[model samples]
Target: MSVRSGDKKTKILNPITIEKDFGGPIGAAFLTIFLPLTTIFLHLCCNEKYLAQGLSLEFNKVKDLFYDEVIVNFKENFFNERIWLVYCSWFFILVFLDFILPGKHLKGVELRDGTKLSYKINGLAMMGLLASTLIARFIQTNGEMPELSFIYDNILSLLCTSIFFSILLSCFVYICSYLPLMMSKNGINTNERILAAGGNSGNVIFDWFMGRELNPRILTWDIKLYCELRPGMLLWLLINISCLHKHYIETGGKLNQSLLLVNLLQGFYIVDGVLNEEGCLSMIDITTDGFGFMLAFGDLTWVPFTYSLQSRYLVLNPIQIGWLNFSLIILLNILGYYVFHSSNSQKANFRKDPASFNQMKSIKTKTGTLLLCDGWWKLSQHINYFGDWIMSWSWCLPTGFNTPLTYFYVIYFGFLLLHRQKRDEDKCRKKYGESWKEYERKVPYKIIPYIY
Candidate 1:
């Protein structure tokens, strides 16, 4: 009998099968090598002086069978460079394994399967992120302790300092990683164009990680459902604290002023991105980074270590010093929240029923004939961006400007929106042709009123 099975039989394999099978072994080897090497480096750098000082602190037991001091130590140590390195070492190794191993071919799953697929791991990028994280950690640990030199027990200065660094560090981490990905030749742009051209529209994790054994779409839905149930407001608050506040305390800490007033304002932009939903959805993963970076490293490193688990340490502690600023800060938060939430809601409502809320009219102007009228969109072509800037200012206000670093979020976001708006305009002009010309004539402004 002629064996027809060899030519006809098809094999289906999950993308993760190889990683799942080999991940543990690879991960184990990495930790075994990385941990010891890191410890040796620390030992060499710190020598007996630091070690002796570290060891001298005795653990005083308390309630919860874990002493408060011990708990504090755990929190602080979690943010330390050593712990971060150890954790990253494991993931780094897994990425390394992906690089080395021959990617398997399967009958059912292929990059051309109309689905976006990333068969190889982003080892180089991951390594760069790990390095940047290390640098941030090193600066925090080695940098001069935040001196309360400006005022004799001035609490506001301290709080401002904390907010400044926290925001700065967060921005640093974000920009270092995101800029490369966005600008890379074989990056999100390629994926976006690919998806637009009738290819598979699966989530980014599947495409970036080559883990096709699991349906990434289902996983993404599950994550969204879970996020929806809990709502990330609290998580955002928590994670933001851990990540950003460290620099504040290390450089020159202050009060627990509500940067949320600012974040609330920033939220308007964030929500706008969310409403856009296409680019924004990918942002969460990009920001949080597989929980490996955020949960394992972020919570321990930034939250407890830098800020010492007291978000309000700088803002609340020195009531007398920050009194005037605190009052102003509160007002800013309120304004930010009002503008942010109101503008977003207005946009959402307008989008829901454009005819009812907004009146469409064609107008002749100096530029040309364009669509003009009244409503949210007509109020200003991109009022949401204005609200976004206001919110960013409010958040940065709390930092009180020891350095301009804290304003990075607002500045970066503004630039991002402007670029995006320009890009969208170009696309609209190309797609809508004369309709866009007429619309531009009607609108007359890009982002702000009587300004641009």
Candidate 2:
């Protein structure tokens, strides 16, 4: 087939054509080695143990009968657990709907530019996993919290087993999700091709502002490892911190300080992360990877990172509140969001339409105007790093000044950006060589303007 640009009819391969078989034992081997190794590394650093009991319980089927009851207990303990469950349920439903329903896959359909998910298939896959999870939970627990037995006796072990199976199930369903697209095209596979899907389906306001252009696929770093590691790492850290905080609170009874501000900020950060799936996928690391990579990163890394910390911490004790200071907390939280969101928006827009920029200003230096500096870019070639730092700082606000330890994320991010900037600079120097030299002549500082 052919597509027209001007006078030329460009030969276009079927967008869904799978001419080569990339998924095989080799790919599966690669995924297994990558996920578990990274998880183990994180476990070691966090001082977390993959309890043998937990590993054993993960496979026991007797645990499946008591899952619903356990979740009920979970709700009694967590308060808002029911609402959370409902929300999760809805999400799985939506993903499944997109997978099964015609025109919902976000591939080939051209009414909008949303990223594809098999709503129909995703739903079935998720439901199957959820059912299996419940069954595993029930059979393992059997409506009783027996005294801590061993891997064969613990809920956590059962959960681990459930997640292992769930991951396998999700991958199976995900593969099946693509089969329809494949069969429709007579066994053609087209994962790499850019095919328009869901025409003009975005929100009216968003459509006007952003248009239907797909996000650019650019690789500034090898962030696949980072993405895979980040979620699991985050979860584990949260669990450890929770454990620490619980110990502190239990020992001291109640304190004279409040943490409302910090908790709110953390909530916002998490919600924002979920809402920006497209932006997340826009990152070069995700686009460069195939389905196997996605499964490894999303399941092993992200899921564990986000959950482990809170689970560990909450089990230890409760978050105590002291004095409430609402005003200052709100303002700082807002400032943090402004910095983080604004900088990201600027970069996205700039990449889409660099010519939309009105001014072509340059900074003057001993070497002449050179190539660096001007506007926000002049303030910091990597303004987004500053924004990210601010957000991380705000999220840690709830912890207060008891210890600088709570602010680990911000500190870690600062170091990360510095390293990334240096790497980027080195790459630029190599790629552009002399031109990069000229650009740097105009802008000297790395992150903070005039300060760093």
Candidate 3:
């Protein structure tokens, strides 16, 4: 990767010399093993059968990790053909929708080579079409919904299938990144296949985990962007709905308040994401990160399975929240959303057109980029992250502290956001130098207001 500085282009060499993030190669290898296992472990702990057995999420139960029955069950159900077919079909359907859907063709940020990639802004439309189809099916069935409960019933198998495919996709992209570029009649442009910064560490395990290509594309279809929102995020909503449907059926047409809230809140988040799909183009994942195992596993498997933990927990252990608590949770989410949305909007707007924020207090970086010192940006350097963390708490709060497992999302998300914030800070410190220190001094806090 190369950064354009004035008329000079600074070239970054392949195979980064020094490695630190993700604990270098050894840490990457450990995570490669640990992340998938963690996902599977969480699923096993929170599954209907395990919860029905009156087991607590205590450390003593760790011994059951290698129980004969558990191992046998996993081995038997881990590779179901039906589940694989369903998973693959859903993925392909999303791909097909991405191709045929109509929306504005927005251009992405210019690359080092001054090339702009066009992306379709049809995620919301695709979501609507899918929802309409599902609704139609429900209507056609005379008010009887399709077997969405199947998703919950076969959750383990689905997770396994997704993991398998994530690894497969990661391998495919990693190998493709190394292949020599084919020369076009117009001549070869090496910039068309740029490696991700820090992705080429000369360690296969680390590189594979971190991702090789900055933006791996097959023709015009961006694999990373497609995976970012389409399959994993939409599937998360689908899983919540499935769990909700299961609860509804098992309770004889009654819905649990906590389950309902989880569904509504998470569904809203997913809808908001789909509607604002264009915003993803500027996110760190799309602009900076490579398409590798870290992202693939997170997008394909970890998100849908682990994010729906609260709903999954409520399925077997329904927790009833009082109206007062429910209203408080809703209010909390509203506040969080306000902070998240407004802060992100301010930053995006400033990035797109700094002139619009001329009246806003700002500091210009050495690279000619302006940082706002007013509005939400004034509160904290990563005020948006604070908002996002707040919302994550609301998602888990409805679970009512029965098991620490249910609260995993909030805790894990807090750490994840902190790690991401640190990454952004490091990158900014390097890019902006003393200007970043000035921005930090002005903002004071990193994520929370009046706190560290």
Candidate 4:
């Protein structure tokens, strides 16, 4: 519903939450559009050329640099057939596969209305299908595959396209929620609209950013699930593979150790995500948050386009990682994935049925859910977040002592998880009251081990 600040001073992310009330409601609305657009613009601005130009500019020269690059070169990269085709094809393929594939039907947690939404789980199958399709294409072409180079060549074009799609989808979903009754035939009219826990504070900017509704559905389609797991996650892997292919071509078809290590670790991470697809249903983003601009932009644009930066960086500038470092990196990734996956599975399994893991001990509270103060949960209140931090760093380290640009995910993700952990703790406190305090006392650390 809303991100947690330091304490329980929960501010609804509306227009009034702005630092200055220059234009009032208009200011809030402007911010809702301005912030995300600026981030996207800056990301485009930080392209290889722009960054180089930035370093070479003086006070007055900066304006000239911006005019030439931002206004001139940016427009050139913003539009390309390769970018458009790849972006469109990627979206179409993922959605179509999700539609036609067979999956196991499962029920989510019961909502306040006493009904559980059913979801079809088939992400792992989809991954296999994608890999097989690519392999088939490679084989049919007699070991030659050129399509993968498109992403490397048209990174900016793809980025602009992704931003366009994100804005389009966010607006479409907002409209769907805004006029659901009118949009929904048979006049299944309702007086009150369903809003998320901390959303719908009557601030247009805040509501637009945070989203107003929880579990928005169109017939059997759950919009949140579709965005959260299906498209962008796979798209991220596809981008990495493209980077790998392009690197291979440039490096005389010989992939270096650093790039290979990054590719392998990320591939494992994605495979883990796909294999444990059901676990995602229990996460906060799925059961709690609404489908809004924040999530829409994040899932559609930021994830696929930005998250694979390390691999993208390594494509043009190949870094040689020694075998020792490669092995160490692999071990670190495995450790992180092991802890992250185990903690998530333990908690999910505990919630599904406490007896699922016989060795796993938990404290059963009065409200009925068990507090897992054993195993990974004993290490920290949010041990999985620590694991995520470890893996994010591992993903970046392969780039070596390079520009700070490659390490952006590590910095950004750390803050994200910090806020997420605090938010989850706040949610638990509200849900379980005194019992949550007891659980916190039992597991003192928030994220890291003993130190934090």
Candidate 5:
């Protein structure tokens, strides 16, 4: 292992570590229910579906609403077996493509246990396939595009299927993680188990939520990595496309300008992520976060259903996008993408060859070394986070200054990134000690350049 500089402290909680940041089992239980419920409710808010006409939120009728409205509505609208079969078929085909498609077999960053995992680089090819499939299907229908609208129409059932499958997949992850240990003739060094890097935390609810295995797998396939990219991202684009189709059909082929901007920006982002698929190796999700329910659900359901909320809303709401406003949003996304790509590339290049980043210097710790503050990293501990923020809001903005709902993604993302920044800082402080403190002093801002 290459020696890297660090200081003192406790590190971030591993997923398999029995730490209760969400309060405890009760809290996790609530989240387990709440997150999926919120996923449904948000879709409800965007679509305003299944609500009785003239019904309102009232404290006096809160209990009645819970029993009659929430429970009954969810029960009825939740799952449709036909939709489930179709969606699952779509998903497995993507998996088949991921397996069959060829690309570089890249190695990931070394793990705490010294394992360097491998992942396939077929995302870009899969993305091309996704586009081609959609085009071919639509063209076959003579551009009527009902299949596209089918998703927008039956979104609730689709969400149910994704969430169900995510939970099922997490169960599979938990089981697979322990198979090696249970099967071993010798009392297995549990730590050396295949794909279960960090092992189980022993709390089922927490394990299910946070993930038990560090990098779960199936035969030769990298389950976590494949999930991290394939289904949700292409599904996100597909949902946006469906929204576009719905808009076109509604307005006699006139596209909603706001919807167009949202698609272009998010479409660009997804395509970039796929094309730069190899970079997933060094991402926090790949390196650290476990393959559990939190991620499984998020990658499959939350991402596809919630992340495209604005696009979904715009389909129903159809907001105006003026030329000036569109120009501003375009600029914001461009700037954000530029900073995000440039800052990440800068750090990645420095890691590969510090000499390439001429301004980089080394700080020697008692054991080894760490990179000196330079470029965007010098500006802020997580400068690219700000860039990411800019891009997120720009996508949200075309919804205009109407409902607070449209702005939710930006608001949620800001808080999420802030939590991530602190997590990274804590991890660095534990690893780098006083040197991390010094670097923190040098890079005072946590994300934004002047204002954190």
Candidate 6:
């Protein structure tokens, strides 16, 4: 019931209440199959060869989804050992950086046992070192980048590798969750293993999909936190940069404005994510959700592959943008970034030291937590989501209106943010009860101002 930490004992909550999320077992099963297939389908749909043969969402072009050349290429390249080696090497390098990197060890939110886990905040440094190594290699080769297009060429294989790794990791952690506490000698504290509230449904499929262990770790290396940012986020930026280089080489050193915008905006987003990595410690993924198949696949495969679709799209369809359009998109992203960053900072600061935000109005709940009600929080319950959605458009708008496929990121991100907001509201309502209702009364809009 309690664990000793320092001079005091911390009480641990018991029998975490099981709550069926994502429509329970059937939905989990559906998503487990549907998501990966969707990623593959989207990749095929956006394939250069398929697009060259008039790939569109039209009924007649639907058959193009099964284009012979594309299918053959994917099948042939799906199991490239070289690609797998590069992907695995990248992962292990990140792990090495995580272990050896010097950083401020920030304590994460207290767990059910009322003990905090220390996390190394060195993502920015890691990014810098990786970028420096890459740049040094580029300089050494006189800017003759090592077949950067190989990434684009072997993308399918890379994706398969990530998906396989995610599945393998999920299985490993799930099995380890069943190990005895004596396994702590091997650096796993099975006694501290707790089933996720939404994942302990007694159904293996759903549990695996949703993640069985709440905080599966090896010694001090928190697997969930490490994966959340290191591999996927960095890989996303790397892919975007590689796409830019691919475009450069293919276009004979001519830079596409649209591609540049996509790279710059997304680069900024990724850089910000890495620099402010500590902000994610309190997010739902790290604080609540288990490191399951959903997160594993999302972090490894979905994020790097799907989120970089615009950059990948522009590699084949390099659309030119006017100065007017470019300026507007930049302004839009700046606005979005401002709101997203400031609001998050306010919330984080408020959570850490509510008294520091004395000027900002907040509603105190019976649960002894303060819900911010002023500043950006007054505009919407999830103003950060609104900002994030706004920025998603900037990433897509540069691809032009030639095909709806390029806009998939914005569309999918919008839905994902909306779902996340709804989930957050539901959880807060259940946690705070009438106080949440009061907070809602003070801040009516869910995400957008004067809108939904």
Candidate 4 segments exceeding 4 Å error: 1-70, 73-86, 142-144, 180-193, 355-361
Tell me how many clashing residue pairs each candidate has: 25, 61, 0, 1, 8, 0
lDDT of 6 by residue, 1-452 (tens): 22334345444343444678888889988998889877776777677766622235665465555455345666554666777788888898889889998889998887665467778898778878977988998889776577466777777778777888888999998888666444333332346565576676677888888887887888788899889898998888878888898888777878999989999999989888888889898899988888899999999999999998888888888788999999999999999988898898888888889888999899889889999999889999999998888999889899888888888888888888888887898899899999999998999999999988
lDDT of 2 by residue, 1-452 (tens): 21323234443422322222223334444654565444433222222232212223342331342343334454442334433353245334544443343321212122111223221112234334534654575468762312222211122333333334435533543333223332222223333323212111222222111111221112211122223323333333333334434444445634323333443455446445533434644543343223333344454443544234222322322344334545565666677677667767766666556557546554333433234246566677677667677666655555444334344456656886887687567655766666666667666667777777
Per-residue lDDT of candidate 3, residues 1-452 (tens digit) = 33333456555434363645799889989998899878877877876457823236455564465353346676555677788888999999889889989888898876645567778888778888979987997788754566586787788778888888999999999999987656431332544476777687677988899898888887778899899889999889989998888877777889899999999999999999988989999898988788899999999999999999888888889988998999999999999999999999989988889998898999999999888989888888899999999999899899897667788888899999999998998899999999989998898898999997
TM-score of each: 0.41, 0.47, 0.94, 0.84, 0.88, 0.92
Question: Which regions of candidate 2 deviate over 4 angstroms?
Answer: 1-94, 97-263, 289-295, 298-300, 303-330, 360-373, 400-408, 411-434, 450-452
Evaluated with lDDT, which candidate comes out highest? 3
Q: Go through the candidates in order and give the C-alpha RMSD of each one to the true structure.
A: 17.9, 13.7, 2.5, 6.0, 4.8, 3.3
Clashes in predicted model 6: 0
Predictions ranked by lDDT, top down?
A: 3, 6, 5, 4, 2, 1
Candidate 2 residue 130 Cα shift, in angstroms, is: 16
| Model 3 stretches with alpha carbons more than 4 Å out | 1-10, 13-17, 52-60, 65-70, 183-192
The digit string of per-residue lDDT tens for model 1 on 249-364 reads 54365424344333344334333432333322223232212222122222222222222212222232222326577677557656655665676666555544655643554443
Which runs of model 6 end up more than 4 angstroms from their true locations? 1-17, 52-55, 58-78, 182-190
For model 3 the local lDDT of residue 411 reads: 84
User: Which pairs, if any, clash in model 4?
Assistant: 13-206
- The digit string of per-residue lDDT tens for model 4 on 1-452 reads 22223354643321122222225456546755675554454354345654422123455655654466446766565665666677778777777777778888888876543347788888878878988989998889755576666556666667667766776776676666565333322222232234565445566566566666767776666778888876778778878888788767666779888878888988888777886788778888887776777788788777877687778667657788899999898888888887887888777777667776657666677788789888888999899898889999899899887477677789889999988887787778878988888888888899999977
Whose lDDT is higher: candidate 1's or candidate 6's? Answer: 6
Cα distance off (Å), candidate 3, residue 133: 1.6
Q: In model 2, what is the error at residue 433, expressed in angstroms? A: 4.7
